[model samples]
Each structure stands twice: as structure tokens, then as C-alpha cells.
Target: MRVFTVAEAKAMIPEVRERADVIIRLRANLAELSLTLNTTGESPAGGGVAEMKALEAHLGEAIGWFNGHGIEVKGIAPLLIDFPAVLDGEDVRLCWLEGDERLAWYHRTELGFAGRRRLA
Candidate 1:
């Protein structure tokens, strides 16, 4: 696991937000495709097998980008991500979720997002 310092995590906030935006858009597109596919058995957006696969592929690639960077992806529905980090000698995760403008939250690894607190 790559353990990041707060500075390190914060440094990547812009890139993270950009990627999150792309993932968010792709997810929306995929969901729309799924809804259409399930509703009338066809997609008005020309979403045949190829179109669906392309959307899936793009989504996979976007999410995989984080994995490749050693960041943990906790959720896709709201795009929660965590950077493994140790603060004050204790292990924790520096967390970011979709719609957050900055990297300013964290929680102990065991507590998850429910235990999130504002970064001091």
C-alpha cells in the first residue's frame, strides 16, 4: 500500500477532481443506457452491444486509473476515494468524495466514511 502524506494527497486534488468528473459523467451515461436497455429492450442512443461495451470500457478505464495510482476506490455511486496515509503515527485514509472541492477529510482505516472528520 502506498501511504501518502496530507500534502501529497492534497497535491493531487485537482487531478482527482477531474477524473472524478469524467467517471461521474460516464456512470450517468451507463445508467441511462441500462435504463433504456431494460425498459424497451433497445436504446434510443444507439446503445447496442458495442455502445454499451464502450461506455463500460471507458468507465473501467477511468476507475482503473485510480487503482493504477494506488488510490483505493471505495464507491462509484458517489465516487468516494481514499489515499492510504498515516497521520500522527496512526494509519488512516485521506478521503475524497464526488462534489467535494478539496481534500479535507479523513478517517481511521477501520472506521470508514462514517467516522470521517474534517482535516485539522
Candidate 2:
């Protein structure tokens, strides 16, 4: 529940984006493995189950990195993340989505991404 200033949150974007990319790639790999399992009705050769486990663990580690930093990871497919911050003396979430060039949106603590308003 740590709160960050806008400058602090913005400074974290590069590392956050890098980790988010790793999660995105791992998720894609996991989805592909799931498709293979579904279509073949059996695990692929070369220890696919173990590979999937490793991927899942790796993904968890990436997500945990964010949580450990007091950042919230909200989605994986499109890589959404939020940083707790104080805006105008009230708590808000500084939101960032994959492909965003910077931390440019935010919403009140009670709202989600749908309520995001561009930073002024």
C-alpha cells in the first residue's frame, strides 16, 4: 500500500515495462502450449509438462517482481499495471498499459481502468 509520487512512478516505467514484456512473452508461450495440449489430447514430447511448469513459475516471478515493488499487475494478455499514488492529496492508481510510452493515466482508488483519466 505504499504510495508513490508521480515522478517516482514515472521513473519506474522502464523497469516495469521490461518485466511486463517478459511476462507477455511467457504468457504467449504458455497459451501456445495450452493449444498444443488441447489439440493433441496429450502432452508434447520432451517434457512439455515440465516446460509449462517452468513457464508458469517464470511468469509468476515476473508478476511478483511488480508486487514486491508495490505495483499492481492487473492483466497479462495486454499487460496492465497500476502504481499507487497520491494525487491532489487523494489516493489514486497511476495506470499503464502495454505499449504506452509513459505513465499517462490514473483513476481513483475505488475505480478500475475503465475510470482512468489522463494525467493533467
Candidate 3:
């Protein structure tokens, strides 16, 4: 697991933001497709299965991009991401949600987002 310093994680925000946008959009599309499929009780007439597959693939790739960079994705809808970091000599996560302007929160490794505290 890679651990990043606060500064390092902060610096990565721009790229993260870009990728997060792509993920959010793709997820929305997928959700819409899923709803359509459910309502119709069948795939759309023209390559709906293929479209879903491609969307899934794109989502996976977007997620893989974050994982490859040592960022942990916690949720897709709100785009929760955690950057491994050391705080007061103990490992923790620097948390960033999709709409946040910067990295402003963190939490203990086991506690998750509900345990998040403002970064000091």
C-alpha cells in the first residue's frame, strides 16, 4: 500500500477531480440504462447489452486509474476516495468526496467516513 503525505495527496486533487467527473457521468449513464432494462424486462432493441458492457468497461477503467495511483475508491455515487496517509505516526486515510474543493477530512483506517475529522 502506498502512503502519501498530506501535501502529496493535496497535489493529486486536480487529476482526481478530472477522473471523478468521468466516473460520475458514466455511473449516471449506467444507472439510467439499468432502469430502462428493468422497466422493459429486456435489453433495448439495439445493442443495449453491448452498450451496458461498454459502460461497465469504462467505469472499471476509470476506477482502475485511481487504484493504479494508490487511491482507494470507497463509493461511486458520491465519489468517495481515500488516500493512505500517516497522521500522528499512525496510518489513516485522507478523505475527499466528489464535490469537495480540497482534501479537508480524514479518519482512522477502521472507522471509515463516518469517523472523518477535519484535517488540522
The best candidate in terms of lDDT:
1
Error of 1 at 39 (Å): 0.7
Please, what are the lDDT tens digits per residue for candidate 3 over residues 3-118?
99999999999999999999999999899888897788566656577888999999999999999999999999889999999999988999999999999999999999989999
lDDT of 1 by residue, 48-116 (tens): 767889999999999999999989999999999999999999999999999999999999999999999
lDDT of each: 0.94, 0.89, 0.93
Quote each prediction's TM-score: 0.96, 0.93, 0.94
lDDT of 2 by residue, 4-115 (tens): 8999999999988788788889999899887887687556665577877888999999899999999998888799999999999888999999999999999998988889
Model 2 bad stretches (over 4 Å): 42-45
Local lDDT at 72 for model 2: 90
lDDT of 3: 0.93
Error of 1 at 96 (Å): 0.4
Candidate 3 wrongly placed segments (more than 4 Å): 41-45
Best-to-worst ranking by lDDT: 1, 3, 2
Clashing pairs in 2: none
Query: In each prediction, how many residue pairs overlap at the backbone (N, C-alpha, C within less than 3 A)?
Result: 0, 0, 0
